[model samples]
Target: MPQNRPRRPKVLCLDDEPAVVEGITRTLRKLYDVTGCTKGTEALAVLEADPGFAVVLSDMRMPEMNGAEFLAKARELAPDATRMLLTGQTDLDAAIAAINEGQIFRFLTKPCPPPTLRGAMAAAVAQHRLVTGERVLLQKTLRGSVEVMMEVLGLVSPTYFGRTTRLRHLAADLATALGHPAVWQIEVAAMLSQLGYVVLAPEIAEKVYYGRILDQRERAEVERAWVQAAEMLAPIPRLEPILWIVRNVRRTAADMAHQPGASPDLVRAARILRVAMDFDELLADGRTSAQLAIDTLRGREGHYDEDVLDALEALRGGGQRSRVAEVPVGALAPGMILVEDLALASGMLLVARGYEVTERLLARISGYPADALATDTVRVVLPREQAEAA
Candidate 1:
């Protein structure tokens, strides 16, 4: 059987005038699927139904919501969609100003020639493909790269490496609660947040993991590690956003509010990472109960954003249940969270509870001579889907 031809990219045109909607739709429908709306609000409804529209063209002047306002909201609704502004002579300046606010991809003056409109739509379609294509690539490749890099870090820095793993899980939970997109970047940043610790003293990693207090000088070293690790990862392709989030993971909420120029995604990822890291520190120390940790986070002014804390609290209220299974070392796989202290015969802590399991970590654990180990069956908290399967 022959495969069906792929559908053409969809375009949305919004204007208060029926004539304008018909004109734009008629001009583009021959080459593309066009959704035309005479009301900006109705267009928003159209967007809500199918956010996959490749291009949004809105007139600069309209009742209630103007082009800029509509496109701004549209940008939030479908960030990957390319936005274009249609402006009259009198509204050109307003449209230009709205460019910054709406993050519009292109603008066309009123009475645009059919040729010019076609070209602009073509360019918008190309831009949409570029943006959405890059996002897909990052989602596929970067996720694997982050996993392997963190797993390799485990070979030399098991304690702090484990903290990064735990933080990733917590960050993911918070992201889901807030309907925040870009969760892949958030999870990757949480894992890489501990990269700085790999260069610090071994004892320092253990201390930080266990929430052991460090003197001023030691604290400075930890801060330095944070900066250094972020710097190292900054040059990698498609990792710039995650690095920014990781570098600012320790910044106060006040600092975040003042950095008006940073990407909202960056701010969001950083805020969640901070709360999760701090919350994990308390858990690792065993000095505070889960409820107490939540309370402490709430009172730490300028530390965790209120919205972030609220999301975390909502997540906590649900009681995150864990599913554990006793499995031999040979059955271990990457990404599992250990529920017990994995130790060698000499009683050295090989790995700690709440640690994210990885292939490299498992390899080392299994490499230990059989005579030096007491038991082969390790208890691990399986991922939800896997637990369900079991």
Candidate 2:
């Protein structure tokens, strides 16, 4: 068997002058897979086609789009790619604009020596590696930790975990329906939004979960618990954005309207989560149907984002499309959504309706005594794909 060589990092070089682009490619060809383009528009097209480019280098004075404008668009196209600007020694204004607009990693003056250009390309590649490596590490470590925490929540508080799981799916769906970006962050926020309930007395948590009215002191205590949960998660690396959503899941759109430096996406995500959670709770006690719950939310003026509410209303029809069936506990499978509250014969709620079953959830469910369940047959909506197959 032949040993395979490691793949070189891809570098995209763009300039109005074909000769300059060719020069850049020549300097970095040995260490990188270089693609040279004479126009910024053409380079942008290349970037859109293959976002795997590790670095993008552009000259300051391009015909259609200057270096600053090109790199700024490139940032939106391939955020992980490191961008650099090559400018004339007198193009100091353009260099500053590049830094401010494109978040250029580095800028080199024109007539740059081959050795210096090579080193700059090498450094840009290294920066790309650092960014991507940290992202991978964060996903593996932080996301894995979150998964473990959710599993523990299942073990300790199955009811809340079920709510968390359902909310996560709902948040993702609503985000897509609303055409919101960064849907994963909204999903993660939903998954962890109920962490505060873990510390609450079961009765209080159940009341909150079921949307029962709370007294002043009980409401205050619940607020304290939410803050504590956010504090506990604050120590996790790269989790600030998600934590912000979780902490503000209860905040209305108006509440966040005037807050300084608040991101629109984050605000939208928080609103999405808030609506999903409240809607879930409305149906939790089995007293309200989806339409009635939506109506109730609509009546609460300015309490939620109108756009998010519209998305929720639109997604309501999707549930009716799924094929619902009653299955014995043992026959239950992943991807099925619970259609009714899962309870014990003693009338204790184990899991709420709308939860998507998973293997981990099955493991948790198995811990209950056979005779403890209210019924052997449980109602579930088969996932759309499975329903189609059936």
Candidate 3:
């Protein structure tokens, strides 16, 4: 007999009768790691505790909760899990409810043969794989492309996006603290929030960075470029949804929360990018420290959403501590993170703080034989192992 694979995707089967549950388990046990439950409540408990079950199969007409209701709960718990309904032949309404409300992938009549049950389970598992695999691809591939673009921008337009290294971390932290599902999108948006600088003149960029009032024409140009960036980025694959959040970033917190064009995830991503951008600008002004900048924003009503404000507060719970040590430029390694802004002899910012030193940056530093860059000591944050070694 062919033995069941230990690493096969797990499937949870729920039915009111022990005999039915046992039969279902026996059928699927060879292909999948099957768990049999006599009640829907037990199945739900398993989903909550483990959440690794790729397919949830529930029988209709259970005493505690119907198949549709149980599957609905399952959907809320594990949206990625494929739901399937097993109903009696006469229960047309039950099957329809499962399909419509529970969003079940397939419904089978009671007394399904061993081969039929096997095929249905195979299809459900395939659906689960498709959804979860797509999510992983988006998170990895899209994030990678966005980071590459930001890295190149950081090299060319340091003053604009250099500060964004810190902003990205802050926004990502806040999104994680609030349990935002599309956290990678929010972080990518934060990093690319200053992308409009690609179009702005260096002087105009400085004016915006320092919070100086721009002339009517300059302000209008900046505004147009800000909206133009989304249009430019929309053509990239998997970036359409991210640009959707980026475009709405100009909207106020109230607009983001209530606007018809913005979905809830979009609203969250918009608020995060908005706060991250404003917070970065506030820090760049050098009027106050990071904590004080957040404090100032907190005092300005209608400027930020309260939940975002709370998330920023949580971020501040760890006060700023300069853990980096000064090292000569030659001592800089590829893995180290810059602790302070690096500027050229002409006072043009070269790289923003919190940027990880890369081989490319190392080569740039080597090319600059000037006294300010080649021989000067720069501050950098070291990883725990490197710090200990030092």
lDDT of all predictions: 0.82, 0.85, 0.81
Q: Please identify which of the two predictions, 1 or 2, would achieve the higher lDDT against the true structure.
A: 2
CA displacement after TM-score superposition, residue 47 of candidate 2 (Å): 4.7
**Cα-based TM-score, every candidate:** 0.86, 0.84, 0.88
lDDT of 3 by residue, 194-308 (tens): 7877899888987887788899999998988888887788778777667878778878867666765677778878887788778777777666687888888888888788888
lDDT of 2 by residue, 1-390 (tens): 457988999999888998888878778888899999998889889998988999998888877989999999999888899999888857667778899999999989889999999888889999999999987787667666787789777767878888887888888899888867577778778888889889999889988988889999899989999999998898887888898888777766777656654788788888888899888888887878889999999998878878878788888865534788899987889999888778889997777776778897788779888899898989999988888888
Each candidate's number of clashing pairs is 0, 0, 0
Candidates sorted on TM-score, descending: 3, 1, 2
Residue-wise lDDT of candidate 1 within 1-390, one digit each (tens)? 458977889999998889988998888988999998888889998888889999999998898788888999998888889999987847556867679888999878888888999999999999999999988887879888888887667656667666777788889989887777888889888888888888999788778778889999999999998879878997898777777787777776567656645677778778888889888888886667788899998887766779988888777766564577888867778767886667777876677676777665767776777777766878988877788787
| Candidate 1 runs further than 4 Å off | 1-5, 48-50, 87-92, 109-116, 139-143, 234-240, 259-264, 286-288, 299-302, 319-322, 358-369
lDDT of 2 at 289: 83
TM-score quality measure for candidate 3:
0.88
Candidate 3 error regions (>4 Å): 1-6, 257-261, 319-322, 370-375, 384-390
Q: Give the candidates in order of lDDT, highest first.
A: 2, 1, 3
Prediction RMSDs, each to the true structure = 3.1, 3.4, 3.1
What 10-residue stretch in candidate 3 is worst by lDDT? 314-323
Candidate 1 vs candidate 3: the TM-score winner is 3
